[model samples]
Target: MLLFVIDLLGRTGPFSETLPAGIQAVVAGSAQKAADFHVNPPPAAQCASCHAEHFQDWSRSSHARSLTSEGFLRTFPQYLDFVGIRAREDPQVSMACFNCHAPLLKNADSEIIRRVAAFVVAKDINKLDGFEVGCVACHAEGNGVFSGPIRNPKGNLFHASKFSASYKEASFCATCHTWAPASIPCSDVYSDWKKSRAAKQGTTCQACHMAERVGITAVGLPQRKIRSHIVPGGRSADLLQKAVALHLKAAFRQEHLEVTATVRNLTPHRVPDG
Candidate 1:
């Protein structure tokens, strides 16, 4: 089944460019900026102020360690180096990844953007931790923001505040979930979901995956009225468990035993399984 999906996705690669303008932009831009770009951050400490509880929850999740982990680093030593090379060779792609993964704060001055761009071009992966996708990376504000900095991206803006009705909506997830039209078939989770019955029925990935442990029909636990920020549940836990299990398997295998493991995506935006 997975191979079928991959083949189907591969078939779509050539035709994907025929998708709409916005989709084309995403695909082309994502491929182009896989490495280099600059982005300013939002005001400092504002993210924490807005999502204190959620921030804590996210810190506990594996997603928090997306860009930083000794285990991941040891296994994929070339990620940073490759990013650097791509940044120099393909500034457009570098910019795309940087925007999604290591977004800058709004308060970051112009110089900050310049430095960020330079670092991205240099493939300075260490900066990934300091300016990585975090709790605010998704929830703070912007259209279709997943994780990372929101460049000069503009649209109906959402702001976080203590007194207002929270505006954490599906569009936020759509930013990352939706694939650029021109991208390969495997790259379009967001768009796939958008066309799915889930989206039409107003069921969001967050609703099923992040809500408290009430019945699937009623996940709104009284104490946890809002959704969970922990970002667990769904097949994600299954996937992560697979990662750990693979590591355990590797550890148990004799190092001297001749074996080869092809780690497909030990880097950002690449498919881990596909």
Candidate 2:
């Protein structure tokens, strides 16, 4: 029985392809049930207990409010309504929006899924508190392991720790920042960066968002400089000021007033990116 459980856990290579249709359904249903209930991982507060500064930084970031932001709260349910209307025509309509907004739902238990679905369907913006993108969404692996860019980290007693080069690279941000749905470019930030001189020069997303800082990563650990969690983007005033240059010239040509304004993009990619 132990070996059977191990085999089930290790079955990641398309086992459904070899199973009968009824058996496949049963297996899929069982897997979904397990995902919905058995995956009760800890909340973001657990991480805050050890990394208070990082937690505080993240709390003020837009990422912390990805799901609860007024703009997102207004449009998300309308999107769900559109999906519901079109779902009958194409039952396989993609629901990829949740990939970034509600990352937890990727492995949420059935009860959580039902509650979120109900809130979205009813447009109940008030009750959706814990559904936003949280710390574990980006740092934790599927098996409940926490990872970061720190190599040989110490003083961690909460969970297993490991160094992931991807955390320091641009491709990590590309997972969600670059996506095309139904051949329509929803977000092309990652691709834009790739085509820009920044990518050629080895500039990464973390270089701008998660800027370096000198501080302790955890309690009881020596103070070492590390990438900060106060990740910022286009909305950052300092970044916007540095990304573009504007100049205005006024003159009189042939007794007629002529004014010219010049705007130059200092950044590699287009400004005001979506």
Model 1, position 168: C-alpha lDDT score: 41
Per-model TM-score on C-alpha atoms: 0.44, 0.72
What is candidate 1's lDDT per residue for 202-243, written digit by digit as tens? 776566556554221111222333455567532375545433
Best model number under lDDT: 2
Task: Look at candidate 1 and tell me the lDDT of residue 222.
Answer: 26
lDDT of 2 by residue, 130-194 (tens): 45667777887655367888888673323577789888889998877887565333567888889
Best by TM-score: 2
Q: Which stretches of candidate 1 lie above 4 Å from their native place?
A: 1-52, 69-93, 105-130, 139-168, 180-186, 213-224, 233-235, 238-274
- For model 1, state the Cα shift of residue 95 in Å: 1.5
Give all candidates' CA lDDT scores: 0.42, 0.64
